[model samples]
Target chain A: MTGINTPSARHRRRTGRLDWIWFVPFFGFTLLFLVIPTIGLIIGSLTGGHPRVTLKYLAQLSQPQFLDAYRTSIALSAATALGAGLVGILLAWAAIGGGLPKALRPLLMTFSGVASNFAGIPLAFAFTASLGPVGMITVLLQQATGYNLYHHGFSLFNFWGLAITYLYFQIPLMVLLITPALETLGRWSEAAASLGASRWQYWTRVALPILRIPLAGALLVLFGNSFGAYATAYALTSGMINLIPILIGQEMTGNVLFSPGLGDALAVGMVVVMSVVFGLYLLMNRKGGRWAQ
Target chain B: MRPARGSSWLVVLLGAAYFILPLVATLQFSLQTGTRPLFSAYSSILTASGFWASLGLSLFMALAAVAIGLLLIIPAAYWAYLRAPKVRTWVEFLSILPFVVPPIVLVFGMVGLYGNGFGPLSSPMVLILAAYGVISMPYLFRSIDNGLRSVDLRTLTQAALSLGAGWPVILLRIVLPNLRTAILGGAFLVFALIMGEYAISSMLGFNTFGVYMLLTGQTRAHAAAALALISFALVWVFVGFMHAVNRGNITFGPGAR
Candidate 1:
């Protein structure tokens, strides 16, 4: 590829001037629609109904309810991320370690891609329909063994239920993100195994070390993904779940403590948490890229 | 290798079953015929007015959004590839911000921005803009970026210029043709997202398919199941079509008979 370019040609090329006219519409759209609105949200969090600009809204976030919501959000997000990472790593291992038929790889990849995006309300509905009072599984169990899942308080509208629904997407996403890492390891580990290393030794000394950064990075991305999720939780419990995203939505929609300022503060808090997680993901991605080289 | 193969098959079957179980249940619910709840939901949804309207609206919005997104993204991606490679990362990041930020937060921010006289609120246009700008980002950017990376942009430009072709000709005749599949994939993904998107549209008060589903769930359980099944089928069909296209490309090697 480098041979196609000459030194003289490379030197003579100037930094191409951007056609501003071409970008004007897109820039205007993004700036006005996305950037400005976000700025408004930030500012809205600081000021009250009179726009006096006070820290009262941010301070209000310290209340027990808000604090509990934050804690729940963090805990659920962390658990989901960890679950996704472990399942993803194992699935990737199964796929790339010559565990599956080569013909099925593409099929699994496509299935995973679709499933990963298949979350939110539909997923919640599916789970509810399958496990709720009239759910198929609940009905089946009741008929066969005289034991009703819902009659015994087996509702798919609580924290554990939300986490399970989350895994529906989280696991698939992790699989997609980690598969390439596993594939890359396979290429090198095959050679190491050929050099007389046992399977355990090969994984311990070769594959695991190489995959550490990417695996962690993928987990961080999952953490951020689940942390920011709201639609699923909202659909399941209608903002009664008390997750941070649900709390933010409730505040914005005038549910409890319907202060736009407080809502903005919660939004800012969410942004801060996700931004940090995403930053770590970026850092890990950079390191992973370097390691791949 | 042999034992691993057995376990892999087991895992694949289990995974596929897990993914399909909810869909199958929903389908069964949709196809029931009794009032006692065998498949009454499906029949009611099929007979409902809101179901069809919401489905039509979702398809319309998704198509419009995809068209608008392609129009903007193709040029923007091409321009970035040719001129400002250094800022490509920033542009990409900006495009994907909607994905990273929770949909609730994005909707909140959007409502604050456009819910007033400043922009179109409670209108399809705002939803279109959101769809075009936010959901289409990852798909379009990845497609265009991958397409750009696969080709020799400089050589193509130079060849086109040497033959007295303008930038427009090169972009239309050369670059776009090469990036057709990528563009199609991106467009389809955007379509799927828009079709299935519930949070933003529902929050904004537009009765798209997803919103309709939520509403149906509230009012008529059986009808909602039917609607959900219909949506699942539509999305499944689209995903399957894309996969077929991708598989066909793989077999034909991008330029085969």
Candidate 2:
């Protein structure tokens, strides 16, 4: 009787000693740096002041100014994601089927690694000098063709300008993420063709369906990547452009006085948008895994 | 398997042009000062006031971040790999959370929470390093997890335990040596991220290399280009080092000498 225990208790005794010791540092760091601050933001955004709850900040999200910012941010990210996703698939396809020099693949991969991470201020500077009003390309084009790039409506500070600048990093990032998926396509395509499928039929019925999940997943990632970006857009436009991150920066960094609670609301809104995007990403990946197998 | 090579070359050439044009333009811009040598802009950065300081501060911060990130990740990864494999998904989700939660948002929260409670958290150095450590968690965790996956962690631990080896001896002597490549890979990523990180540091008012470059871009365009090229070179070196280490991993498989 002393040695015997109920089955449930014995089962619990065998598996219930949670190995939480190794989690101490991770949980501590996350709680301090990630969780607690986020929680604070949530609380801050919810309450107008101490000991009183208010929806003022959340309600501010409906105002026209905030709406415009959201619109521009979403539009920019969607455009960039679609563009980068399509171009990246092309680049990856070429790397596989383009019959470039053998050394080209590694070289392209290395460059993509650098370019993908090569964002923020320096990237903005490169684009400004390369495409700005008095930039080298502008000056050269003016001298050769006698056409002002700006007069022709190609300013690097406007919406198109930002989109182009975003592509610098976006395309390369897409290439890196999609290359592995593309590499597996050749085998799958061969399998489909061996089964007597025509080229167009193979792509439409078989290849495209298989790639649909990963393609959508990559596009969502690109959207999230651009949506969360701050430094590049901020540097290029100096917060003049109405984007979510820029709007958040302006709200928090007011020259005279700042609104911490309002800023938290904005940050929370950003998290919500990103969460939706990532949720779709997760769903696509899950559905795509079955076909991938 | 090689598809027709026609359109692929067109696409590759177009990409190469788009990628290389700005670099060429930047190089030419950096060399535009008539009196000095073509490398004068680079030389100027070497002699420029506070350039070294900013670069030094960034390096120190990056090093600290890598150390902190490794300290936090290695133990958790090792334990989870050996004991509670079910927790790996949760850990992975947490690790990648930073991507969805942008640095700007996190720093905003930091300002509110710490700026109110802890005065020292407002210090530029402390806040930026903490942010970097958190931001680098995903890469560090993935690499180390991949490394641990390559090795049979449970079997290694059991064998070491059966040999009367202590936990410290097993981890430090046996595990650490086997994980050299992964650690290096993660460290390179951390270094690159820190070197180019601008949003948090700029918002937090830290004088890192990125901050310095941003400030320079405001006034001296050529100098900014020079710094940009220099930053590009540094990133290239890190990528090259990573590639070399990965190539060396040919011998890292099981039973390899």
Tens digits of per-residue lDDT, candidate 2, A1-293, equal 66346443353355457568678888789788988888888888888446788888888878897888889999999999899898888987898768888899888888877777777888888888789888788899999999998998788987889998888888988887777777778888889878888888888887788788888888988898889888888888876898878877766576324355677888888888988998898899899888666
Candidate of highest lDDT: 2
Which candidate leads in TM-score?
2
Instruction: For candidate 2, give the docking quality class from DockQ.
Output: acceptable
Candidate 2, residue A201: how far the Cα is off, in Å: 0.8
What lDDT score is found at residue B5 in candidate 1? 71
A210-261 per-residue lDDT for model 1 (tens digits): 8899888888878887887777788778668888888766665567766778
Please list the Cα RMSD from the true structure of every candidate, rounded to 1 decimal place. Answer: 5.1, 5.2
Error of 1 at A196 (Å): 2.2
Q: Candidate 1 clashing pairs?
A: B32-B39, B41-B222
DockQ of each: 0.33, 0.41
Predicted model with the maximum DockQ: 2
